[model samples]
Target: MSDANGGFRPRLRALDRRQGLAFMAALAERLRPNYLLYAEASEQGDPAALRVIHDLIWEALLVKEARIDFERQAEKLAEMEPPAEDESFGARRALEAVMALAACLDSLRGEAPEAALEVSELSRSGVQAFIELTEGEEDAQRLAALIRQHPLMDDEYDFQAAVLEAVEAPLDRGALKELRRLGRNGGVSNLGLTLD
Candidate 1:
């Protein structure tokens, strides 16, 4: 069962896919660790309503880390006026890190054996909206494009690698160092993407 957000978030409108992914990460942090996020469309029931009692211990650990990263982002963003623009290298890495963390939530989403969010679901529901309001086609396309711009070429590297690779100039080594520390130790690393 989706929240009261009118079922799947509207997909027709062009949304910032980066923002959507970030939001997904935040939502995943709120869920029980044992509980996955997406389910196959053929699933019999609501994956969201599963029992959180099974693994509160593990969930607590993941949640603690996620909360820390989330707080760090909030603090950093707060330092800037109106959140500034989104083209900064550090800023993009920060966003990608959030997206990486959010992927953890994606793993949980398709847990339901029968009710996953595969192509069939989208084909029927316009691939734009689903029973729950999250993301859709435009976001997916944007994500693909964004993925192509990764900082590091290798798959083994993570968010830190991406950020480090992208930021060629050492103009703000100190600030980058601090951010790198945060990225490496945060809940999720944006190694998949490079510094913008």
Candidate 2:
């Protein structure tokens, strides 16, 4: 089906199915920018962030589905034991982090926003490069060293401060007053808001 802009859209059913390994790999490369955009939007508190969030979730889930299909195919065709789960990949922790991010979004949208959002470094480029390096070399030890060197696992970024910083840059006198009004109406979060 084509959208109003005449772009051909994939059918819903087609999108719902598990993609092949090759297809998933291609899609991941294509959609990675969307993940980066999502991060930017999140930091900016852009209302469009929700749409990007949905795309990120869909893309990540499809990758997971492809992996499951590949595992099943390998077991059936090769008559070999299924590949062992690699805890070093930290897939579960990554999912948890995403879930936490979603929850933070919800909290921000609620009447009583949280005082602060604790977030880890969400460097999409770093993650993609790490995946490529690990997959290419098939070396978990090397991946661990990279992770340690890059400090990719650290939750050092502050979400609320980022959002405020992004939004404040373009605020004029009127917008600044409006922001102050809203800030007064809604108690500030423990997340420090610096007005320069």
lDDT of each: 0.29, 0.31
* Tens digits of per-residue lDDT for model 1, 1-196: 1223333323311223322322233222322121121112222222333322112212422343432333443333233211235443333323332333334334333322211122112222211221112323357667444433433212222321233232323324354444334333333221221112
Instruction: Give the per-residue Cα lDDT of candidate 2 at 30.
Output: 27
Query: Cα RMSD (Å) per model?
Result: 19.0, 20.4
TM-score of 1: 0.22
**Top candidate (lDDT):** 2
Tell me the lDDT of model 1 at 93: 27
What count of clashes does model 1 give?
A: 26
Question: Residue 103 CA error for candidate 1 (Å)?
Answer: 1.8
Q: Write the per-residue lDDT of candidate 2 for residues 49-166, one digit (tens) a residue.
A: 4334433433443344422232332223222111235233333222332333343333223321321222212233334354454547457787655544543222112222232332
Clashing residue pairs, candidate 2? Answer: none
- Report the lDDT of model 2 for residue 54: 35
**Candidate No. with top TM-score:** 2
lDDT for model 1 comes to: 0.29
**Global CA lDDT computed for model 2:** 0.31
